[model samples]
Target: MTKRTALVSGAGIAGVTLAYWLTRGGWQTTLVERAGDLRSSGNPVDVRGPALSVAERMGILPELRAVATHAKAIRVLDSTGRSVARIPMSSRNGDIEVLRGDLARVLWSAGRDDAELLLDDTITDLRQDPDGADVTFERAAPRRFDLVVGADGLHSTVRRIVFGPEREFSEYLGLYVATVQLGGAPAEPDEVVLLNVPGRLLALHPARGEAGAAFIFRHPEIPGLERGDAGRQKQVITASYQGIGWRVPELLDRLEAADDLYFDAVSRISLDSWSRGRVVLLGDAASCVSLLGDGSTLAMAGADRLAAALAETPADLGAALRRYESGHRRLTGPKHRHIHRAAGLLVPASRFGLAARNNIARYVLGR
Candidate 1:
């Protein structure tokens, strides 16, 4: 019997894991990523619930546990650098918290032996037919696959070409976020220090003597900010966070000096359905509640479920796709609904909201 074939766009968590499972199920998988190389820097993410089960089955759980973020607690502070609350994280942070890059690397290392990975390439166009989809790449030659999965994340090119324009499906959750590496470390390697003011949050998370700093704030979309221009985005961040106290001045100085910065709007992706014919969506491309939604774990679990469906119905591609969508939707919807509330908790839009949150924190996380 001839093996089936799949092309997974985006080499992030979802894409890599999907490729891993597909190959394990005796399918030929081709993974494409637009970036020149794997992304090696990102904030820590959790692996919990069904995602933990999937990791255990894949035999990568031990590796994940080894690299888990060792941050002891999430320390909250006022604008004046005074500690207001210290929240213990071990109980509710799920099975483990691993840096995003480390998780991706683990997925890649486990799956690379079984699949072909094409870096520095993207799917420029995709044409679906009764049999399969004809794919055209920006730099590579065209090819046909039995199925295509868009695990490309928030602004997925596959989703745009297959489903429709991104704006139609994505709704801004009233905030923006940026993360940059700091030149000088501010906190211990095992601590997450956060300072919150009305509508803004500045956090410094140190790992292995290096710190990754983040700026999240409530703001309307800037006209030219969506283009990923680091200069314009930095200016907006500096302007928005101006005069804010508690080590912000030092962070802003580092932000200006940093050359590589990751910036994007904290938004949600909602679609009526996640598949169209042989083309389907996974991870953030299908339903994203941003980072707060525990997207990394969901992506890993989605890949596991999709691969299971395909393995069960290897001969029936359409039926397998439908099965994957049906099972995955139940897991994503309820989690997505809580994003607005999560936004309020992380970056309150009003002074009243901030004060109310602080009081509750003090009551629960009393020092």
Candidate 2:
């Protein structure tokens, strides 16, 4: 039998995991990432449900636990910096939450030796036939592979090249967020301080030897901020969160010099199907629940599942791709349906909504 070859785009949790599993399953895997190097700046993400099993199976659960973000409680405050409530985080919870960068590093460390990694490059075009896909990269020579997987993320380059425009599949949740690395800690080591003013939420949590400040606010549409312009993004964030009270001004003051900034609108990707012929989509590239939901967990589990499906039918590649999509839809469809409701709770639409959320939180705390 001929050896199988695969090109996995994006060195994120999903892409790395997929490449790892594929290589272990006796297939040649090449991983490509547009970023010059692995990203070390991101919010802490939860590892639960199937993702926990995947991590344990891969032998990284212990490492993840060692570096877990011990955020014991979330201290919520009113607009005036008054303590409204404190929601205790479950220490013995079935899940583990670790910084995204830590998790990415662990996954990459585990797979880098096995898979070929191409950094600072991306696929510009993909032409697929009955046999394989001829992929064209922006900075590398075009290569033919038995399969092409797009784990690039919500705004996936592979998706745009193969599927139609992004706007056609994007579902915005009317919220925008800007998370920047804080120069110094704003709260206790194991605590997350949060302040809300109507539709906006400002939070600071400790991770990666520093603190990260995240600003989530209600935005009806995409802002006028240009892509890749951190200055314009900072201005938009400042304008959007101008009168949010609390320690926001201080945080914005810190944002001016912060280089690691992640800003985007909360959105979901709903694709009728995640694959076209020999090319397939994985993780956020296929179905993303965005910043407000447990997308990282889904991405990890989805990659493992996709890899398993491919391994089951290495000869019949198309059949394997179909099986993966069928199974993935069953897993992610329900989450996509109700993910917006979760986002609504994260960034309430109005003052009344915010009050209702606080009342609900208070009630829960009383219980």
TM accuracy, model 2: 0.95
Candidate 2 lDDT score at position 175: 79
Runs in model 1 deviating more than 4 A are 92-94
Worst 10 residues of 1 by lDDT: 87-96
How far does residue 342 in candidate 1 sit from its true spot (Å)? Answer: 0.7
**TM-score, per-candidate, Cα-based:** 0.96, 0.95
Q: Model 2: per-residue lDDT, tens digit, 1-367?
A: 7778999999998899898899999889999999999975578888888888999899988898898886878877778987777888885546888888888999888778999999999999899889889999999999999889999987899999999888899887777778887866546787787788777888888764578888888766754442548888888788888976767788899898887788876778988888889889999989887564377888888998899998898778778888888987877888888877786677777789888887777677622
**What are the per-residue Cα lDDT tens digits for candidate 1 across 1-367?**
8778899999999999999999989989999999999885577778888888888888898999888776887888888988888887774634788888989998898878999989999999999889989999999999999999999998999999999999899888778888887855546677788889999998888754568888999888874476767888999999999999767887799899999898888878999889999999999999988556378989999999999998898778789889988999888888788788888888888889988888888887745
lDDT of each: 0.87, 0.83
